[model samples]
Target chain A: MAHIVFEQVTKQYDNGFVAVKDLNLEIGDDEFLVLVGPSGCGKTTSLRMLAGLESISRGSLYIDGQRVNEKSPRERDIAMVFQSYALYPHMSVFENMAFGLQLQGTAKPEIQQRVQAAAAQLGIEELLDRKPKQLSGGQRQRVAVGRAIVRDPSAFLMDEPLSNLDAKLRVQARAELTKLHKKLGTTFIYVTHDQVEAMTMGSRIAVMNQGILQQVDTPQNLYEHPNNMFVAGFMGSPAMNFFEATLTQTGEQMVIDAGALQLPVPEEVRSRYQSLLGTPLIFGIRPENIYNPEFAPPGINPVAIEATVSVVEMMGHEEIVYFALGDGHEFLARVDPRSRFTPGESVSVSFDMNRFHLFDKASEHVLVS
Target chain B: MQDASNIMRLLGAIAAIIVGSGGIIALFYVANLVVNRLPPRPRSQILPWVYMVPALVMLGAFLVLPTLRTILLSFMDRRSQGWVGLDNYIFAFTNADMLIAFRNNVLWLVLVTGVSVGLGLVIAVLVDRVKYEPLAKALIFLPMAISFVGASVIWRFMYAYQPPGTDQIGLLNAIAVALGYEPIGWLVNKSVNNFALIAIMIWLQTGFAMVLLSSAVKGIPKDVIEAARIDGASEFQIFWRITIPMISSTIVVVSTTIIVLVLKVFDIVFVMTGGNLDTDVIASRMIKEMFNFRNFGRGSAIAVVLLLAVIPVMVTNIRRFQQQEANR
Candidate 1:
């Protein structure tokens, strides 16, 4: 197993389109590094470049500190699991898993042992003689993974491997993949557009957008401290709400004037935004942080904002109330499921001031403590 | 009102059928009278006459009677009314010219069909990945548009001989002269005439093979190729191992098609060489014996042999087609 490093690697296509721009990442040995982003965000392109399927336009790629910019995929000793499960349809599962070893001229007995071991580990021992067409989607995916496993390469590159399966199968395979990674103890560089997969599986997640890496951190840290507005908005479901607010200092107290309501800033938040006093700032908050007045924690400052509920979506565990503040500003708040609220009802929602995130209005950079 | 109209339409249909049947019966009666006057019936107890009538009539008119007449004419002294058995077959199998024709035909079958299909497969695989593949294929397939006779005429000028002196008008002789060499006769040389004719047949057939194999190559799934590449197999190995096996049925079908054409090749050989200078194939020899020399029995024997040679290949082709369909 080896640590794979991309040292300011860049990929520019012949058509003059930049796919990845100065991507610098160091994936440590035996670590699971996930590259996550929306579609066309260059995550897959970066993975392909590391696999040597795509040519690196500039900068060096190193595996175990050896520069592999000029190496072929086979020469790099890396195996990839494609999104389509690109299995050899004509070959049985045994041959599919044994192909790379056979190409390397491994002895027949050794190939058999390795292939059988991989099949057993993948729980596909009974499926060794079956063709890929005879297997289900999940089974084919496992066979694809097994094909990579028998090689025992320095790193495993998976490009959205579980994206083709149904949701339940994807979830099961996700857990199984994590277990397999731990068992094998090899560095894995996985690429997917699914945020949840990255959040749940990776040792560290690299969020990318528009061919640029936005943030790289642990999933919990990413959730709590996104670096910019895009990362903040992209990382969450029922995403963080943003409102244009004016920061003002009145009598040694800092307050933000949201158009239809004025909210006094708590001391901790005030200190965090002390550098941006008197400057306009954007206030962001997660839906779960906004609560009904009865559920507000004691001794915490609550910024109560009154707005008419425009729509209420009753999820089984909670209710999401879409409320319209004046001047066409709208946001949602997750509240208790049993809360009595309806569309056209004016309700007082309290924002937990401790959880609110403040960002510079012009730069969109988070105003951090 | 609807019943009255339906009855009138039914009467009109019955009237038309009666008129058609009346005309057919009149014609059959006249034909029967004419047939009865020509021959008396043989009394056979076990053989059913009615069942054999239509088949006998057709065979006599088209095949059996014509064969008998040809055999008779082959034995007779050219006017035809005597009997001789095995004489025409003996003359056909023994003649030196006939032996040369047979040799030339075998050479044509092996060289023309073999080289064209081989070259076609290589070209198909090479250009399958090229940009503007459709345009390349159309250019290659353009020659198939020229009729065999037309192609023969076109190449005749190309193979035209111009001896040692004077400005060469033929394209090939011009190149020879320009290269400071004596222009040799391409089609008239006994040693090279067969090759020249084979070249014409190859020109006509390679396009057919390319079109067939190209479609077969395209039908191989992209994922299979990617899988083979990711397996660390080189490009050449992938071609031989994955591509050839996948398109084996198409190769068989195309090879059989060219074989059939090779067996019946006549137009290019006849138009270019007129069975002269060691260029005679089976079809050309059949034409020479039957029409040019009026050797009917020998020609018919050659025709039968050619048919016998082609039947097995045709049967295999049909079975291969059925197997392909069943696979689908």
Candidate 2:
């Protein structure tokens, strides 16, 4: 097991398209670092550079302190699981697992032993003689992982390994992959466009967009404290709601005056926005952070926003009430499932001011507390 | 209704029978007059008939009738005026030139087919992933565009002989002269002249093999290749272990095709040496016996032997193609 470091690494294709720009990351040993982005956002390209499939156009990469920028994939001692699963379609499961060992010139009996062991670990021992095409999607994915596991490489680079599986199987495989990572205790750099996979699977996620690294943090930290508007908008489901509001001082209390509504800001928010008092700022709040009046804590300064309910999505455990502000701005508020809110009805929703995020409208940077 | 009427009318016509029968008979005449003079059809269904009529007539006259006649001639004496009852077969078995030609044909079949296909496979794999791959393939495929007679003429110039005192203008001799070596008679040296003619056939046919095998090489899925690479297979291991196995069927098809072509090869040998100097293949010798010497019986025996030699390979090729289609 080894830590992987991408130090100012960049990848420029032969056609002069810059796929990854100055990517610098350090994944510690046994850490599952996920590179998450939308499609063509340089996540897979960065993972390929780490896997040594694509050449590093600028700067160097290191695995356990060894500079491997110019090394072939085999020489770098890394195992990769492709998004396609890429099992040798012609070989049996056992032969597929034994292929790498055989190439390394390992003894025949030893190769068999390792292959069987990896097969057993994957619970595919009965499928040892079956071709990849004969296996189901999940089994093929496991075989791909088994192929990498048998190598006992310094690190595992997976490029959206579970993307091909059906929804139920993807969930099952996600848990199994975490278990496998725990069991192997090897660095895994998984690239995926699915943010849920990144949040659930990665020990730390590096979210990227347009070939630029936006934010990298633990899943919880990233969710709670996204550094900028892009991160704030990208990380959460139903995304953070944003509205233009002026941070004004009203009788020594900082108040946010969004058109047709005004609310006293929390003391912590006031101090955070002290420098930007009377300046226009973007107010961001997650749907889950906003609630109905019954759940609002007493003595906590809550901002009451008047909105007309446009739609109510009745999820089993919670209700998502989409409301339109008078000025035509729309936002969703997660409320108790029993709340009887109807469309076209005006309601006052409590926005927990302490939990809301404020960003400088000009720079789009979060105004930190 | 009109289409059906027209088809029926065409099929039932008195002129159809006369024209068809005359076409068949005229194909046997030396001139190829009526066969080449057929008119083009306005419609596609009629077009197939227009093209197939000439081929059918030609096959009936040259291949079908001649094969039957050769079978009859095989049982006759040299003069064909008298029946000799397996006398020609006995003659073919005992005759030294006929036996030598048969043996040399077998050697040519093995060497030319095996070497050309093997070299083609190597060339296909080597240049398959090169940066200038199209350019390289075009260069290799260049020799295939040259007709067999043209290739023979080109090689003849290279193998041209000059006495020691005379100027060495031939390519091989000039190269030898440049290297300060004595000029050798490349085509008249009987021990190596067979190989020289075989080289021309190989040169002409290797390009066909390369083009076929190159397509097969490209047909291997990129995923399978990348999978093998990720399995830690070296480039050489991938080529041998993965690539060769994947394209094995194509290789067999190409090899059998070249073998069939080799069995029928006559132009290179005939043009280069006129089947002289220990270089007579079965087809060339059969032509020489029939046309030059007018020995129908011996020529028929050689023709039957060549047919027999080719039938099994053709059968195998057909079966392989059927199996490949079934697999698809």
TM-score of chain A of each: 0.96, 0.95
Task: Report how far residue B98 has shifted in candidate 2, in Å.
Answer: 3.6
Worst window of 10 by summed lDDT in candidate 1 chain A: A268-277
Clashes of each: 0, 0
- lDDT, candidate 1, at B102: 81
What CAPRI class is candidate 2?
Answer: acceptable
Estimate the TM-score of every prediction.
Answer: 0.80, 0.85
Task: Please write out the lDDT profile of model 2 over residues B1-328, one tens digit for every residue.
Answer: 9999998898789688998888767644523344445554434345456457778887999889988989999777677878888777777777887777777888888898899888998999899779999999898889999999999989988988888878887999888887989887788897778888888888888889999998998988776676677667788889889988888888888988888888898888889888887888889988998889888887888788888888998898898899889867
Best by DockQ: 2
Worst 10 residues of 1 chain B by lDDT: B42-51
Please write out the lDDT profile of model 1 over residues A1-369, one tens digit for every residue: 888888899999989999999999989999999999999999999998887778999999999889999977778888889898888766799988998899889999999999999999999999999998799999999999999999898889999999999999999999999999999999998999888999899999999999989999988999899998888888877889988887888888888777886778887556666677777778888898888897765765678888899999999889999999877789989999888689999889998777877788898988861
**Candidate 1 ranges with C-alpha deviation above 4 Å:** A293-302, B1-114, B128-135, B164-185, B189-191, B215-224, B286-328
Candidate 2: chain B TM-score against the reference chain B: 0.81
Give the TM-score (vs. native) of candidate 1.
0.80
